[model samples]
Target: MGTSINDHVDRRTFLKYGGAASISAIFAGCTDNQSTDETTNESGTDSPDSTESDGGSTSNGDDEATEFNYVTTVTPSSIDPMKGSDNLETLLLHNVYDPLLYYTDGTPPELQSWLATNYSVSDDGQTYTFELRSDATFHNGDQVTASDVKYSVQRMMDMQNGFSWMWEGVLSPENVEVVDEKTVRMTTNDVYAPFLYTLPFLYIVNQDQVEANANSDGQFGEHGDYGTEWLEANDAGSGPYQLASRERKREIVLEKNDDWWREFPHGQDGYEVVSAEMVQESATAAGRMREGAEMADQWLPLQTYNDLANEDGVRVHAKATFNPFYVYMHTQREPLDDVHVRRAISYAFDYDAALTDVMSGDSDHLQGPLPGAMWSHTDDLETYGQDLEQAQAELEQSEYTASDIDLEYTYVSGLTVEQNMGLLLQSNIQELGGSLSVNKAPWSNITEMTTSKESTPDMLAVYLSFSYADPDTFLYPAWHSNSHGSWTSASWYQNDEVDDLLTEARRTVSQEDRVPIYEQAQRIIAEDAPALFVMNQATRNALSTDVQGFKDNGITGYRQTFHRYYQG
Candidate 1:
């Protein structure tokens, strides 16, 4: 059995392959924290057997259940596809909107034809032409047209936010043209290798609906807000589901699109309805999971999952993902401004302790700037380990004295693992004769602070996952100089050479040709030590045994496409 990084490796295969933490370590954590009085099922008393498929299978319409319920930490930040970028928002938008292409579940996830049946690139590699799926229809029952494709691309370029970075330099609005009712053409400034990967994010919208609902007195002059306000509560998409209702910070619902262009797998109709309950507390979500909830929150405490593992009808899935947890240093800020100081901080921290104590052996050591799972990742880059002598040596190379190295470290509030990791770093930094303060802030506040170089903390922890399945998805947004304002590049680290390398690499379409450029760039960025590459995270989820066909698609937001699951 392969790892779940490729969903071809199912949950049963993962357990058979021992993809989770060591059983002794997991059970040890459970014994220490799980209460003795928790409920159990007599039928579910048997030990988990790898042969019993935890992934869902097709049903013969015997079950009466229609709605698939899920627990989440928060409501989507926004429903407007061009405005929201967080996990919840992406999850919601991914289902509500269908993109030009879709990624089939795998290690190097392949781009499956979605809205566009086929596409071709021009000889110069500057232009792409896509043939639309003729039968595709929006929730409103309107046939999707080539003009809608043109408008979606233009709308993203005009909004200048939420994934606009992918096309900012490579494509212009004038380059998008409706060749006919079934064909649309896009021309880039130069050759862009990851353009196909990025297409999965270019969610198509009903152009006429958006134009009719646009607010006359708002932003995006002439486009008039581009239906941003209207889209906050409604969807104008051709996806497999339609928005039923939404209540910010509380709940959102989606109903199956009866007019969907494609039939679901195994003669099943897919989920008729999907409900997401916004519960902030992990314990509360875990309780719901134990009480027969189909899906649990993604970031629940490790102990919660360990306890749930013993429960009946519940399958806990822990899969190593593309997400790289980072401890970012504000490169433009003092002390951290020195590359030697940054390197010192990286060396002083204990990566082994982070895996053993903080992450509880659920994660893999990150190779460098990119997660090692990525095909373009290079093993040649230097990695830091806990060595106070080396740390002190690197610190001495900096102009600042040990006493002047007081720093502040921040992590997301309510995340136990992040808080514990912060404490571990605090203790390590204190040992080096420097004072360090650990702070916790809400995710909203952290994102707000990242808007400026001065506001971003001396050091902060966050996990970055790819929106697309290409190396550029990890490299360009998180490291490029042009992406400074976003939370992904909050470190404010910039290099003309690195930027040139990334820019040139993206313009080179061939994967073989791009490898050397990406390698050199990763080597440079790793040496700079802008952020401490902590670990590649393993996403842990408690799923109901009744739910099958759940795939770890290797992309963050698109993992839970409810339409793919079998209720029975």
Candidate 2:
């Protein structure tokens, strides 16, 4: 018998590159109509018990709502399911699209069925078969079937962009097969342990709609543009909401999908409409929240959240996330290529100032690559702290002198916290006799610059997030040699020993076997100091007190699924 395994954007310049710098929220409460079946899969990674939802607090009753207003700083680059990879794009596409499985809370194991009722893994841990939910239908009212699932996988693999890195070497289009109208099977080339964790990223699309809308640009061969052009502003999904309109740099409006597969579990009369307004300035977003905006984006500083909470109608919700804010050093670049230099820079970072001053003590200091909240995070791992003496000592060990250290740090523009972080690093590095120049770039330009080694800056400030809560989600993609050229791996660090350890961890299905392997990798990576281990973020969002049933959806980059929000 097969066992069950459950799991859980950008555009243009973002497309040519892979992922983006994400500083992205959580969902709680209310179970949808989910299958109760407990099918066993071939022994794979252990998963949490299947839950409709782990259960969140719900309101007694709610009045009919006109719309739920949400304010954010960044703009979604593309709505195409396979094209966009940033938090802004995810905040939009996640509502407009449905993944096979949903990561509702903390880790990959805390998954609930979405489009797929349940899935089974083969004996060798290479093949997975999913049973499609019959009631699931795309926005155009077409029934979702096995073919759509297959096509979605094929398209994701074909584009080879965005979150495609999740499946890069493990899966291919030829590996996905439609067994029947409702059953789809996928076979990986290896026993990829994180395979299950990558499912929530496979946002299904209407195969027919894509083909009908495809143009002959030949970007994707016979698939033409594969509906990328059409999907840029439009959505072809079976999610809880449908894209009503997308205004560039303004807002993306979404209306509830009445025909959605799952009904609201709580006494939640979900919002009628959702307006994701793009408000770049934190003060403006806070102002709008005071003026009756239901929710504010996650980018606001800690003080802003506290101020909003003091208001009569506003409350703050915070959840510790696995998203680690990083100061990635280009390991392939000169000065930074030296491990001593990297370690020296890491020692010079002001961790206390970052946590207390810049982040306002909201986030936990990260131990290593993995956040402390993660299951297998190395608790005893020695992490960096502000020690100028140690910094100078490490610098002395480097081939280059302190005077030779001239570096540039780049961060996303308009983010007050990141700017402060850059300034703090600049000051600390200066104390070590190194000059560090701080610069800001728009999110789009940052994504474009990080695409290649030549254009990438010596140091970059970005928050790296995982779609699913697995060690591989952080280790493999963020540090592996093959994963370079993307924002997450912009550090460009490569270690054969660490790579072999991570590879073994991926192949090892059992959590017990994988933990030590992961820990070893963490230790090696931390010693290398390719990136400054700043802190794991605690995301705080302001919401109107009337907005009830809000839960932290575990994955970073993905915001709260608006379907759970209703005015009480």
Candidate 3:
């Protein structure tokens, strides 16, 4: 990672930098073209549910049955799905688990009868209908039922875990009721357009698991819900992969689930995972994938990936993804609490300079909340310019003078690249008649800053990668006022308008309808300036020359597809 190109940053100098506030650059690149109008995610409402070619990409006469099998340093933030989970984990789960409906190649999102083989919706929007897939069974061989869907959705709500935002509006206790052993319906209080995109993440539950940890009452909520210490270390799902073993800071192994529904592309299609395990976060794993290391199957530290790209026995792929990077202003914190102060803070950073000079033109400067991947992304909404004139004018309009405040920007230490962006930001803030102090926390400590009270700081420079291809990817808990985003809303800018817009966006069943709402909310967010939206990243998963068939479904970085992945 310390290695450098001829561009001002030398290998030693790059390594010498500490926190996120050491350098600044300008954002200089853009995606080659807009993503297809009717994007093909391969499944869900999109079209013909079954589409499969051999999993691997082959050019030579040799026929490869499988491809794109590799590992990375990232680990699941959580498996609960109802909490702060990892984007990488979601990608893994997408393959092993099936939602009520899913996005497939080039078609309208369609509901898959994964567990619910068939289903219907009530005449009123309040009730949703589903038919049980009699054959669909969990990894443990337990048949899934309508009650399981009811229980899982309810359990998510009852736990009040971080992920509840996904369904806060879609499923309510008063509305979702099962009609019989084979049917279930979800009726909404009102017309919600985005209801379909919402259910795909509603993974079914096993009554047995709920009963295993239930409270004194016959039900499984009260005290035994998820986010508790139990689910964090265990695994039992109707998925293709099962947790094999794990050691914190080391490696977590996931072996194939033979009982995994056994459906093509769904259950490994009856074919056994001749390979028993998938490893996570091991340096040994990284070493085996680096360039010149024949055994090197996969590696991290983008620099290493770049090196392996041209080497034999490995492969590399890079593409633009939907990850948005930004700097947050704690609405509850000082200076940030003021709209003008927030705007002034936003003006302090030279985002373009940071991306260009520091990142060496590898990123796209952010213009608004809904980046280009979405249908309604607008260039007019971008706000990352150094407008000293407007910033000063805004500062003058505010009641307090610059002398009354001091600012602190806290960042994670592992962000070798983004840390430099922070430094440039610190410099910009100083130019606006303010004091900007920088602080760094290690991964073990920095991560807590997102929620835990002890980790709360005045300001946080954060990055969000959403190229993994899901509407809820960044919208739900992150911006939904009642969710985790609220916990991080230091500026405390709570507008019923923005909230309602997000609500409408999620409830709208059609993305064309949802885009406007998403755009509206994004516009308000930009104006309020709670966060200084930076640039979107172009994800590059560099492997040796041999890796292939890795398709990016959009929410970049964290969501690299690996199912049926293999080495040459």
Candidate 4:
């Protein structure tokens, strides 16, 4: 899918083309001559003065431009804030929806009040009281009140889909109480340490607008569909942007909300519109960027980063992130049910070669699910490195012989890096007298298959980023037995000891006390070998040189502030 003219270039040709001379030659006569007056501040930050112009002049000198472009590989299935599990959807939803608390990206991540003006927690830590801002209003100009917050939480639980697990044991409908128009109180069954951090995922929606657009034939038919059908292409929250138009998997357009409650950090006259198109292929996205296509602002892929590193008017930003990629082994399936078989497959993987040759040395091989930056991570666990003799030995101990089974490996289609990793895995397994059949599908189809235990493949390669900074973000949904049928737990591997450890760890408030409990859980899970640790991914984005105010949060990776971006 990524095939292009650049794909046929050899290693020597790539290096030659990536030089400064080649870059200058490629854009000699096509460079824009108009100069911008905006300059960086004393602290070396891209902070333009208020008197600066709205948009920069292009080669054609058009002065009325008010739109910014973005490109992505996958299209969002639904814009419903409560029904999405991917990062791309989160980026789009954050622009049109406001959560109770907002996580700001910085040296140390902090949660700031957004819809909620203030909040308090009881000494026992089971009850939380929040004060809503009186000035906050939805897109329809409806005042946001305590009742809207209560209804939004209840609606999410009633739908019984998408991120409901975030509040599974912490909250319920009966525990929510509206004290007044601007005050609300919520009580939990026990002391959940991650409760405050998890509030960022609970987006507040206008109850009146949702109820008026409700349909009876939706996923949740009993509650008049809870506006599930209408929210797919619409927005009802109070944020900086509102939905303008959408064509499902093709493109989405957003217009600035002039009456937004918060002022733009840069200025009031930032880009008036933002549009994102689904390119699906890395080569096509890169080609568009080089040709100065109006729809090309960002591109994804390491190969694209290499190809465009020296191009004029292009910048590449890379940073270590909390996301980790792994190959999940479906323990509920036949041959994978044997722990020996899973361990053997894990040992046969050449992680170093995959990171160097396939990934272009842009990623770090992970020790376990938790990244080293997290507090609870440890280096005490055993890692399964490439050892063909050890792999063969483990295979001999399994119930079935090497020829007894043919493993089915699946990965996201249109991703060249993933396809290469899958092929490398097949070769490694073949060396140990095992067979692997590689399969590929679109991300949307793979996500659908992961919802059911029977539909999940024997092995699937996927990437996961933390929803919160705590260790529970990596442990609870992944290793807990209750998450068996969910897409987060495609491995379908469960252990009672690991479940009890994770449950206790979440309730433990003191970081000192929780460390040992999480360490014990990580050790146990590593010994069980439910999934093979692949690599810790780095957030990489190729953008036009004029793009500014794009900060990558170590905790939330791609959650960016669109209102802060100005072309000049």
Q: How much does each candidate deviate from the true structure in C-alpha RMSD? A: 7.4, 7.4, 9.9, 9.5
Runs off by more than 4 Å, candidate 2: 4-65, 105-109, 266-268
Relative to the unseen true structure, what is the C-alpha lDDT of residue 65 in candidate 3, on a scale of 0 to 100? 28
- Taking the candidates one at a time, how many backbone clashes does each contain? 3, 22, 80, 0
lDDT of 1 by residue, 71-157 (tens): 875455578888667676777888889988776544335566788887776677777888889899998988899999889889998
lDDT of 2 by residue, 1-568 (tens): 3777554210000001111111221121211211112223233112222325322223234444468899987776677889777777776777889988765533223566788888988888899898989888999999999999889989988887678888888888898999999999999988898787677788899999989999988688899999998887778899978999888888889987777777644323457788989876788998999999998877775566656666778877655545577889999988999999999988898898777766555567879987776767789999799888999999999999988889999987767677778888899889989899999887778777877899998999887756665677777878998777777788988899988998888889988899899888998998999998887765667788787656554564444667766667
- How do all models score by TM-score? 0.88, 0.87, 0.77, 0.87
Model 4 Cα lDDT, one tens digit per residue, 1-568 = 1111210111100000000011112222222321212233433222432344433232123456467777777766678977876666777788888888766543334566778877888888788888888899999999999999999889978865666777887789789999999998889878887887778778889999998998877666666888878898888989888999988888888888877887665553466777887777767777766765332322254545655656777765554555577789999887889988888888899988877777656567778766666678878778889988888888899997778658988977666666777889999988878899999887678778888998998888877646765778777888898666666788998899998898888788887899999999988888889998887765555667766666554444233467666555
Kindly list the per-residue Cα lDDT of model 3 for residues 330-435, writing each as its tens digit: 7666666788888876776787786667656666777865556555665568565888887788888877677644777776544545556667777787788777
lDDT of each: 0.75, 0.75, 0.52, 0.71
Q: Which 10 consecutive residues of model 3 have the lowest summed lDDT?
A: 7-16
TM-score of candidate 2 against the unseen true structure: 0.87
